[model samples]
Target: MNEALTLISFGENGWGDEIAKGVIVTVTLALATLPFGLILGFIIALAKKSQEPSLRMAANIYTTIFRGLPELLTLFLVYFGVQIGLQQLLKLMGFDVYIEVNSFVAGMVALALVFSSYASEAFLSAFRGIPQGQYEGGYALGLSHAKTMRLIVLPQLIRLALPALGNLWLILLKETSLVSVIGLSDLVRQSGIAARVTKEPFLFFGIACLIYLVLAIISSSGLSSIERWSKRGDATR
Candidate 1:
């Protein structure tokens, strides 16, 4: 018991600080990516539902390419490929600037792209599920397109998309583990380091598993609350 306690202690000898910092990084990456992902997803969903054939086709291609690629490959493309491309562009422009894409930024861009692709389908479905009458009625009532969307359509769209978005959020949380491959020092990487140094593979890996499970549980609880809140107004109607 003492040995296990010592392993998780916060002092210089323990890996507690490193593990805690890793958890923070993992959470930060997810949070930072989420809003941008959702916004891009909303735009893609709108594009897919647009009257223009070209817009629909473009959105389709965007979703198909990102969703079909492996998440790790996307990360590699963003981290290594993008950095190389940027440096080359700078050289071509006669600027001697060497641009470095940090792991956090790369992870954010890659994951956000993936999330937007997947979430676009959910948003498209929600948008289509909304009745055409609502659009007509809003216009009939002198509501501008922007005001109609904000006051009427947005609520229903969010309500319809909540469950799918919650599932996506859970998936996104787990997928953050992949960022460790690009040297983000996230939870899995920190655990691997501790295990390697202490030669306690099972112990450290087990701790990592427990940490992930705890995070999942907490996220699930929060999502459940959001889902319930989202439905409350509709339930009364």
Candidate 2:
């Protein structure tokens, strides 16, 4: 209908612009969370592999706690808890300046925590999958520790981890929707607004669903390419 078209039309009279912006925000947040989560997860994996029992125990506890908590609950706790704690600390210091936590920052931190928890397990498994003979061979070749890791260990580890990491990326993309719950103007939030204003929930929500499907398809295609590339060395052998 012309009416439905108009509701999604570009310009001040419609929500097309808002929806576009929301899509961008959602993508940006997911991308931002990716590196931080991977780095933290890498650290946790190493910690668990460490000889120090204390370090291993600490890493285990961290993984258990974050992995056990629901993502939404973690978001709420990080967002509101940090905000309240910061305000209280500022009051105690007599600064009196009001500080508000940015929803984007909170979302990034919370999601990163959740992402790392899951990713660490994948990384740890990849680490363990490397054969002991590889390390011995590297040392026999007179390679230093760093060089051995870079030359012999990393490539195989990445190949092993890529599939799981790609899957996690897909999950993270969907999880970005949860950020909308905390007032981030992500795609779902924008669509909800449009639906409420236009009184056409089905139209707007259906549009949102299609958009997400397109994104997932695109992501899956890219992941497939990466997986193929990772396996190229094996394929040749």
Candidate 3:
């Protein structure tokens, strides 16, 4: 037990600092991805709910393509394929420069796309649950379409979609591990490196698992609070 403790101690003899940094990266990546994912998802949901057939078709195609692709494959395409395409484009423009995609950027973009795809469905469902009278009520007060959505529709939309979005957030948190595949040095990669160097796979992996469980537990608690807060004045229980 002493040896194990020393192995993970926060010094030259241990990998505790590296693991800590990895946790930071994982958390930071998730935080950075959330707003973009949520906003894009909300936009996509609105597009799908639009009366225009072209807008609806485009939104549906976007969600279907991203949702159908495996996360890792999407990451690979963003990191490798996009980079190559950019490089080629630059070459065609006579700028002969190599454009390397940042792993963090690639991972965030891929994960955000995936998260938004799923989130749009949740938002769409929430939109459907809302009555048409909600829109009429907003307009009855002389609110513009955008203002009506921003002030009235949005609050209710968020309240209804909070639970589903919370679940997606948890999934997104776990999926941050997938970024390690592209050399992001996230929790999973850090743990993997420590395991190999120390020849204590179970120990390091177990620690990783514990860290993830703690995150999930904390997230669940926070999400529950948010859900309760959103439902606070509801007459429909």
Candidate 4:
């Protein structure tokens, strides 16, 4: 037990510092992806609900394709295919530059696409849960459509969507591990390296698992608080 502890201890003979850096990368990637994913998902939800048939069809197609594909495949496409495409485009433009997509950027894009696809469905459900009367009420108040949605509809939509979105956030957090396959040096990758070098796979991997569990627990607690706060007005009513 002493030997195991020392192996992970924070010093020259241990893997602690490297593992800590990996955790940071994992978290930073998730944070970087969140807003883009949520905003894009919200936009996709709007598109899915648009009166224009083409817009609705396009949104549906997008969600279907992304949600249907395996996430690893999506990452590969983004990491490699996107890089190739960009290189080709640049060459065509006479720039002749080689383009290599950063693993972090590629991971963020792929995960955002996947997250947004699922989030759009959740947002759509929330939109449906809202009453038509709200829109009518806003119109009656002489508010413009956009203003009504922004001022009145959005708050309720978020309240309704929060639980599902929270669940998605947890899933997104786990999915960050997938980026390690693309050489992102995230938590899982660092643990793998430590395990290999120290010849203690179970110990390092077990530590990695515990860290992930802690993150999930913390995320759940925070999300629950946000959910309750969002519904505070409803509670008063």
Candidate 5:
């Protein structure tokens, strides 16, 4: 017990600071990618429901390929592939500088890919859940489809997607640990370093677990609140 207490202490050898930093990095990376991912997801969901066959096919292929691929593989493709592609573009312009993609960017991109896959599905379901007659009524009232979606369908869709998106956010936090594999010193990686230095695998790994559990609880509570709010307005309907 004393050893366990000493291991987590905030003195010169403790991992309290490192773990805190890790949590920050993880959360920041998740937030950084969420807006972009959500936009991409909504667009893909639009495509999936598109009137055009070509557009629907494109969306189907994209979602299938991305969802089928292993996340680590996708991470490699995004980080290294994007870096290489950018470098080639620079090279074509006769620029000689090396382009570096940091772990934070890589992690965000990877997690965003996952986020978009699930978010697209959620949005698609939300889109279908809207009554067909609502669209017809809007059209009868001379409202454009775009306007109808914007004013009527979308508000409810946002409410419906909120809970699923919240759950996705929790997964996003956990998946940030994968960034450590790409050489990011996120929470898991930081704990790993301390474990190596102290030769105490159990201590560091256990601390990582505790951090994960605490984060999970906090995230779950947040999602529950959001879910309640989203459902609150539905009580009478």
Candidate 6:
């Protein structure tokens, strides 16, 4: 216990401060991106299910394009390509704006794009699994389609997608490491910094792993609570 506490001490030489800051940034990134990705995923999923062939094809293309590419390539494309694209657009507008995309923003956008692609599949499948009779019943009760989706479909979809979402959260966490390639000072990046400074990969990397484990455990427990709450009404069944 003493040894462990000593390891976590906030001395000038210790990595405690860096690890804490990294964890905060990582959690912030994850939480901020998760909701946005879910919204985008739902939209894409709805698009995929639409009767319009064009809309459905567009969504299908978006999912396939994102999901098929390597995450590393996706990060690079978003990071540099978006910047270049912005610059070109600005040039066309006769504005000399030196647009520098924020690392946090770029990382979130890249991760969200990938997350939404995968999440759309899970969410769409969940929505499909819901009995058609439920929607009919909802219509019979005078609920608007939007109201039925909001009050009925979404709840069930979220409950059903919780497990996949949890797994995606973990994947997102690991993928954050790749953002280090784009110069985001995430956990892995910070750990590399520490290693360079301390010349002790063992200590810094070990601490980083522990931090990731803690974050995963905390996320999993929170998701478990969400799962429980979502299913509370069906406990009797």
Candidate number with greatest lDDT? 4
lDDT of 3 at 13: 94
**Per-model TM-score versus the true fold:** 0.96, 0.96, 0.97, 0.97, 0.91, 0.93
Model 5 clashing residue pairs (backbone): none
Report the lDDT of model 3 for residue 12: 96
lDDT of 1: 0.92
Candidate 1 structure quality by residue, lDDT tens digits, 115-195? 999999999989989999999999999999999999999999999998899889888988999999989999989999999
Residue pairs in collision within model 2? none
Relative to the true structure, candidate 1 has a C-alpha RMSD (angstroms) of 1.3
Per-residue accuracy of model 4 over 134-182 as CA lDDT, tens digit each: 9999999999999999999999999999999999999999999999999
Q: What's the CA error at residue 94 for candidate 5, in Å?
A: 2.9
Flag clash pairs in model 6. Answer: none
Error of 4 at 87 (Å): 1.5
* lDDT (Cα atoms) of all candidates against the true structure: 0.92, 0.93, 0.95, 0.96, 0.85, 0.86
Segments in model 1 whose C-alpha atoms lie over 4 Å from true places: none
Task: Check candidate 4 and list the clashing pairs.
Answer: none
RMSD of 6: 2.1
lDDT of 2: 0.93
Which 10 consecutive residues of model 5 have the lowest summed lDDT? 228-237
lDDT of 3 by residue, 12-71 (tens): 999999999999999999999999999999999999999999999999999999999999
lDDT of 6 by residue, 1-237 (tens): 565555557887466787777777777888888888889998999999899999999999999999999988988898999999999999999998888888888889988999999999988888788999889988999999999988888899888888988899888877887778877777888888877876778877888898889888988898899999999889583
TM-score of 2: 0.96
Write candidate 5's Cα lDDT for 16-104 as tens digits: 78878887887788779889789989999999998999999998888898889987889998889988999999999999778889878
TM-score of 3: 0.97
Among all windows of 10 consecutive residues in model 2, the one with the lowest summed lDDT is: 228-237
Candidate 3 wrong stretches, greater than 4 Å: none
